[model samples]
Target: MQDAKSTRITFLLFPGITQLDFTAPAQALSRMPGAELAGAAASLDPIATDSGFSILPTHDFASCPPADILCIPGGHGVADALGDDATIDFITQQAAGAQWVTSVCTGAFLLGRAGLLDGKRATTHWGYTHLLPLVGAEPTKARVVEDGKIVTCGGVTSGLDFALTLVARLKGDTVAQAIQLAIEYNPAPPFTSGHPDRAPAEVTLGLRTHVYDAAAARMAAALGATT
Candidate 1:
């Protein structure tokens, strides 16, 4: 009893994926009318997340159905996943027939590796935005950037914003609004510093020195080797 109007949304799941990048969007998009969500990986084995937990895929690359929306979520694993030919091939194949191809955080790098971001304006986590050009993308600063059928967003929690935005596009504002209300999507962070642009200089510098400096370098090296 499958609905003819069902919108199939497939997410690429990989080891060390940022769980929030996958789950936040899944929460919003799955609530859209007639929306079906599927997580696909290379195999059915449990995929580990950066959060010290694992997620089981609904389908493997060989058995997954073509999707209306194909999303790639990023994490520490993306650097390693970049070197996996099968993973890149899967993304290439899935994006070919998807009505909308998208990514969150460093997942944009995966899309870029698949030759999807060539000459396109894209974005990723701020630390890695500068590396987008290595993959033939013009890095645009925004939580979400839509260049044609390709949509890319910034790091982690931005997935929630990206999902609601896409839901509004696929269904309608009212439906998206209702879903937002249902999920209580309102955001009021205790801190004023979310992005580097808004964060205190010392705070941003500390984070970059501690985490993103090394992470971005690894990502850059990965992209450089691939390109």
Candidate 2:
């Protein structure tokens, strides 16, 4: 069992990472008892979110200290981040040593690329989920899937739900539920435009092309002929 007095939680930050993917859950984790939150980036500098939010990093991958928990939040930059040798080296090292490692959305792509998700069941943003098999992962459609110590969450906003779920698993449902309630998470969608099936096919197609085309091109460049 980990000593409750001090447990570190490291979050890996790359350029263009999704804002909410790291922030919402990061806030929750930071508040947990005996929790210490640290953001790892390319360097101890500011990294811009996908939405252009700026975050100052705590440490770089090279100098990062070990922790009990680790997280990776993904976005358009995932293609670049995943293919970086330094980032992958840090993740492979830290994840191998940590008690638990998790990712939100396209962050799973990083894990998959690093070979961490190989032989593990995982999930990612549905758009790029098709590529998981290429990296030897057992992909699932579930919003969140846990296989051993590694946990993964599906697309974008699902990071919030995924992090909450993982919090329940780690800190107990009572604690997680308390946080959820405190956050007023009883969301009621005003429109029925949530799921792929519900949205008009045209809208979905447009969105797919608009959002994913660049990411797809980047992925092709990073992955090349290798999986």
The number of the candidate with the highest lDDT is 1
In candidate 2, which residue pairs clash?
none
- Please estimate how well model 2 matches the true structure, expressed as its whole-model Cα lDDT: 0.81
The alpha-carbon deviation from the true structure for residue 223 of candidate 2, after best TM-score superposition, in angstroms, is 2.1
lDDT of 1 by residue, 1-227 (tens): 12359999999999999999999999999888889899999999999999888999999999999999999999999999999999999999999999999999999999999999999999999989989999999999999999999999999999988998998888778888988999998899999899999999999999999999999999999988877
Q: What TM-score does each of the candidates earn?
A: 0.98, 0.92
Question: How far off is residue 188 in model 2, in Å?
Answer: 1.7
Off by over 4 Å in 2: 1-4, 225-227
lDDT of 1: 0.94
- Candidate 1 clash pair list: none
lDDT of each candidate versus the true structure: 0.94, 0.81
